[model samples]
Target: MSKVLYIKANAKPEGESKTFRIADKFMEAYKKHHPQDEIVTLDLYKEDIHFLTVEDVMVHMSNEVEEKENPMKRYALQFKSADKYIFAEPMWNLGIPAILKAYIDYVSIPNITFKYSENGPIGLCQGKKALNITTSGGDYTEGMAAEWDLCDKYLKTIMGLFGIFDYTTIRASNLDVIGMDVEAIVNKAIEEAEELAKTF
Candidate 1:
């Protein structure tokens, strides 16, 4: 059975977060479809993730044995071993939350997630898929605002850097717009999340 790593980055209560609700639906459907599969939920906001210091960065850059026993090695190991990954985070100020970014930084180690090659950096965790579920207060699909959308593109690029080329993105937009049908938008995304999880 495949192992699924679900990263939850929303700091709000689940009931108040559309992104979390959609992720819950996806995970529930995934369990129903693949009962034998194992699911690991990592809450970034609640996790003790340290900011990488200059020395810490140097330690990872060097192929030293000390890096092998790093206290934060768990995240790197989890990312490397997962068969599939699901990232649920809301768009905050046109980008992913700081906690999520910190988690990414924690896992994107030199040898753990990627390595420099003769030509360029090569991703080691290949052949895995990622599903991104994000919510935005304002819609940016077809306007100058699109230029301000950094969440999807950033996450997608990070996933590719880690060799997770196959991915699906779901967005709940205009959540804060006045008179907008936020319920409809969120519900539709929730439904889609369940459908995608069946085959994810």
Candidate 2:
């Protein structure tokens, strides 16, 4: 059976946040289409992920030369265990939360999740897909706001390292602003996410 890993980065749970709601809708549709698939969820908000220290980086670097195991190897194993990935986070400071970034740093190890070649970097975690679901207080579509979207770009690049090129994004923006219908926008995003989950 196919395995999907849902990584929830939002600090709030359930009705407390809109990003969680969107993720729920997408997962529901995905499960409906692939009932036999196995689902794994990594709730980063609840997990204590530490930032990579200088010692950690040195250990990884030494492992590359000596071909030895590093302490951060478990993070890479967790990332490779899934056939698909889903990141549920809110756009914070034009990017993702610190915990999600820390998690990526821990997992994105060379020769484990990826490798360097003469031509370019080659991904080790192949045949996987990803879906990114985010919510923002300001509208990021078109001319509504500045296009400084770091969350999407960062997630895409990280997933690319694992060869997860087939991906989709569901966004709900302008929640804190007035003159926009919040319910309508959220419902539309949910509907679109449900449709996208079918093919995922």
Tell me the alpha-carbon RMSD of every candidate: 1.5, 2.5
Candidate 2 segments whose C-alpha is farther than 4 A from its true place: 62-71, 143-146
Task: Please give the clash total of every predicted structure, in order.
Answer: 0, 0
lDDT of each: 0.86, 0.83
TM-score of 1: 0.94
In terms of TM-score, the best-performing candidate is 1
Error of 2 at 91 (Å): 0.2
Relative to the true structure, candidate 2 reaches a TM of 0.90
TM-score of each: 0.94, 0.90
- The top-ranked prediction according to lDDT is 1
Clashing pairs in 1: none
